[model samples]
Structures are given as C-alpha cells and as structure tokens.
Target: TSQHFDTCLGCLACVTTCPSGVQYDKLISATRHQVTRNQERTFSDNVIRTLIFNLFPYPHRLRPLLVPLFIYQKLGLPKLVRKTGLLKKVFPRLAAMESILPKVTVDSFRDNLPEVIPAQGEKRYRVGVILGCVQRLLFSPVNEATVRVLTANGCEVVIPKSQGCCAALPEHQGQAEQAKALARQMIDSFENTGVDFVIINAAGCGHTLKEYGHILADDPDYREKAEKFAANVKDVQEFLASAGITAKLNPLIEGDLTIVYQDACHLLHGQKISLQPRQLLQQIPGVKLKEPVDAALCCGSAGVYNMLQPEIADELGVQKVENLLNTGAELIASSNPGCSLQIKKHLELQGKTVTLMHPIELLDYSIRGVKLLRK
Candidate 1:
C-alpha cells in the first residue's frame, strides 16, 4: 500500500493471483490514481523479458544452436573450458546446470552400440525401435536391453537408422512447426518399412510419438499419416505387456528383492500406463513391488526440466527421495532415462544405497537370470 501511494504502472500482477477478483473494491482506485502519475515505461525491461521467453521454450526452432553444444561435448572440450577459464563466461549458467545434467557421451548409442536381435529360431512379430536424439546417445544400453527382451520373446527387430529424433524435445515446448517437420521425417521412415510396431524405450518419447495425431491435427497430409503412424507407437513395456504372450521369468531372484517404483509422469499420465509395468514386475519370482506414496507426482526430471531448471528439479527429486526413504527399499526402478539417473543421484546423497534401474533392466534380469547390480 505504501509503495503505491506515489505512482504505479497498474501492473496488477495481482490479477493472476486473484481467485474471485475481490481486490477490485480496495485497489482499483489506488491503482488508477497512480497509473496517471507514471506514464514513462521502461524499454530495457521489455527486451529482457522477451529474450528470456524466446530462448528456453522455443527449442525446436533453436535446435541448430545446440549442434555446436553437442559437438563440444563430443570433442570433450569441457575440460578445455575449465582449464582456460573460458567456462566462467562462455556457459556460466550451463556450467552450473551441468552439475546435474550428464555431459554428452563421447560415444552416442547411435555411433558405438550395435543393436542385438534375438536368435530365437522362430521369428514372430516384426518391430522397429525409435531411439530419440538424446536417448539415442546416453541410454543406449537401456535400448539394447529392450531389444534383448523383445527378441527373446520371438520378435524380429528392425531398428531403421532413419528413425531419428521423435521431435518430442520440441513438441512439449510448443514449437509445433519444428516438431511437425521432424515428426514427418520419422513417420516417412517407419511407415515405408511396414513394420507391425514402432517400439519406444523411453515412455516420454512414446507418449509424444503416440500424440503425433494431435501435433499434426491440422495438416491435411500429415493428419492421415500421423494417425496411421501413431497406431504403431508403443512403449517397449506397453508392447510387452499387451502382446498377450506368457511372460517368462527365470529362477534368478530366489529371495524377495523389494523394489519401490518411481512412476514416470509420461508413462502413467501421458500414456495412461500406470498398471502394466507394475503387473509385469509382479511376474518375477520373489520380487516384491512396493508403491511409494503419491506415485503420480512427478520426480521433477520431466525431459529437460532437470537439466534446464535444476533448482525446481532438485526440489522435486529430493521430495521423491524422501518418499522412497519412507519405503525403506534398496531398489528404485523406473523407465525414463533421466528419472532413473536423477532419482539415483538424489537418493545416493542421503546415504541410502538404493539402486535406480529401468523396468526393462528388471525384465532383462528375469530373462538372463543373472544379477547385474553394481558392486
């Protein structure tokens, strides 16, 4: 009230805060009296606000700028930046942010890893896996594990090299045009092959790929293509669960390994796939599936949130760890790559030696009948 006594711009940031607009009776006259007093508007403030909004959310249109970033990480120039003091100025924010964000791998899954198809003397359903840009890099092993389980179940896997970015990075950011163009690229490559399904290892990408119909809803050509293409989009676990085949479990886990699951928001909320993964886990011998409280709340590592907004992500991650702590379980398994890592890191800080795993990893264990825990 004292600040408004002299003059104001009537910004009324309170309008967004008001539940019923009851502020009208007391503040409007005071605000109007000040609006007449201060007519000079600042130009620099507008420029700063516009620039902040333009940079972060418009990623699809801005992906070109990230090429150099990926290149630097690939070349391992972060060391050069640190040694030369260039990091302080060049990427001050990113340098701070990188504490949580894993550096780009020297070998992206696409370049170094070879995808394996099962040697199951019987070839059954043919499917292709869509490895999104980031997942194609960091979580290659998880994708590889996905293929192992698929092929073990008599699937002839065909991972088309052309099945590139799912455009999900931009789709969620409201950069629809950029996402559509990339989506068209992915649809053309997979549709041409006439595969039975396009399995997605990451739940987030699967959800986005499944929603290509909505992304291209207005496009005359793309709408039809996306609809047909989306019919094939399946998260690996969803495909496995819905395949109507008897799931196999080896005699590996003789004793109960209590696992508290952190459900990925994209898997549960985005794809409405809350129960399938849990049901699959129940099939394992002596495996106890423990549900953490409020499993629906996000672990805060939604796609790029953990990387771009570390503070908020950290808050959420810590909260999730608290929930896991209450369960007193040693294993925290999830499907999404970022969530596995973020939850793993936060839980580790609390001196609780919890193992964060991909649900696909557990399926891999049940198939292989060998424990792969890090000693």
Candidate 2:
C-alpha cells in the first residue's frame, strides 16, 4: 500500500476524469496521512524526508542557503557536476535537488514589495496575496508580477508580512501535524488583513489555501474561521477573470506572441480552473494561445515529487515538455513555481531553449508596456 501510494502523482487528474465524480483526492489525502502515522521507514528515507520537511516549509531557513547556492551557480558548478555526472552516480536525490536550481539572480535575494500596494485607479477590490515559500524566495518575480497585475486591475494588494508557507508541500506529503500547524499560521496571518479576497498566484498554494477548511475541521476554535478564510481564497487568475480585468494591456512583444499555458494540476483539476488563465492571457493585445496535446497532464513537479521521486518525475517532465513543444508555441506560461522549475530542468536536459514565465509575469509585462525578450 505504501509503495503504491508513493507512486501516485496526487495531481488530482483522476478526480477530474472520473465520470462518477469520485473524490479520489480526498481519499488519497486521508490515506496518506494514515500511512504516515502507521508505517515505518528506512533510515535513508527518514533522513531525506526530514531534510525536505524542515527546509522547504520555512523561508527564513531557506534564505541562508541561497548565498552559497548563488555562488555555486555563478561558478558554473552545476554545469561541471552535470558534465561529470558524479552527483547522479553517488546521490541521486541530491542530484534531483540540484537539477531544478534556477539561474539565481540578484532579484532572488530581495523581497522589496511593500506590505500594502494601492490600486492604480479607483479600487474595485482589496485582496491579500499569499506568497508561497518557494514562490517568494526562488520565484520572487512571480509574486511581484502578481501584485502589479492585481493593482493594475484596480485591486489593492495586501501582503501580510507574517505569511509563510500554506502547507501545500507537507499536506501533499502526508505530514499531518506540521501541515496543520502551518495552516493555522497562514490563517492567523491573514485574519486582520480585511481583504475582500485572498489572492494566490501559485496554483498548488491556492489549492491548499482553499482546503484549509478541511485541514482544520477538527479544531473547534478554527473550524468556522478556516471555512471563512477558505471561502475567500482565490487564485489570482480566477479572481481577475471573475471580477473582470479593467486595466489596459499592451502588446508584450512586437509580433504575434504565441504561448502555451501549462496547467498546474492543482489549478486545473483541484480547483477546476482551466479556462480562467487562458481567458486572461488572450485578452492581452497580440497574444495567441495554443493548446498542447496533453494539456491536462502533470509536469511531474507536484509539489516536491520531482525531488523525492526523481526517476518517475524525469520521465513525466520529459513527456510534458515534449507535449508543450509539439504545440509550436514560442513561450510556456506556467502558473506554479514547482512546475516552472521542473519544466526548466527537463528543457535543459533535452537541450531545448524555450522560454517559460508565470502567467502573471506575462500579464505584468503587458500591463506595464514592457516588451518581452523573445529568443
């Protein structure tokens, strides 16, 4: 049972496909939590899981390592390691971790966004933004883009400085106690924000944020609060589409810009949001959206699945990239940080050079009239 559950991608694709409308995601989630409590693991498995749970959920903990990581990448050590294949031969898990490291920029070390940003025009809605752990640290630009896009749409954006991880990573991995603790912290962070909607740019974190009700159902004090919080949570794209985008958008590039939107499973299946993102993208001037062959397929970056199960993740990543490439689209619009990183790694592995951006990032460029640099 443990082995079988380990192989499941937890992408919730099955939940979307089931004709009977079975809630397999909930079932699997409950089962995984039970397994975590009952099952014993090998020492090595414990070590890796311990390392991941400790580091990935906390931004302050992850910040210290970035300087060294920046140095490592600046020295082109990753290229040398990949060329030698020493890391893969000796420690495949660590190799998996290294393979997804993005080109760290000076921007990665900065968190310059203010706690509150006013709307560009008359404010239509005030929304709180939840910056996921990896989303804020590694893909900080995406959060910035989200804020810009939201404010441009006549929405005041509030980022609770107290916010941390939404427990998406641990929740998916069946770390029940830790997930609950983090969920409580997330709810507390947004309690006093007084926003109309809590916006999340990352798909996985959005899904988890919306599930806080279920995650805290047993906690008598938080049950009602959790449900209220979950009710207000919205993916940034979802909110913009429903509330309507009022901002003027310019062409992102000179010519017709073709893009294929990669569906992060959490947004596509978990939240039933396949259309909202594309709708927002198409509204941009001179943008053309293309459909991939397997548009609903997972990119193997289901949270930390790529890091934990590298072999299966590599195969899925390769297949996903191939499908996206087959569309003949010039750029890929990825809404989740994990998907962006996993897709990036496989693109490098296959020696392909297609550009990838978060949907919000593209929207930001359009709103600000900044031309996209296309290769």
lDDT of each: 0.67, 0.91
The count of backbone overlaps in candidate 2 is: 0
lDDT of 2 at 152: 87
Over 4 Å off, model 1: 1-96, 103-119, 244-247, 251-254, 373-375
- Judge candidate 1 at residue 82 and give its lDDT: 54
Error of 1 at 215 (Å): 0.8
Give the local distance difference test score of model 2: 0.91
Instruction: Return the clash pairs for model 2, or none.
Output: none
Q: Which regions of candidate 2 are displaced past 4 Å?
A: none
TM-score against native, each model: 0.74, 0.98
Best by lDDT: 2
lDDT of 2 by residue, 1-48 (tens): 777887899999999999999999889899999988988988877888
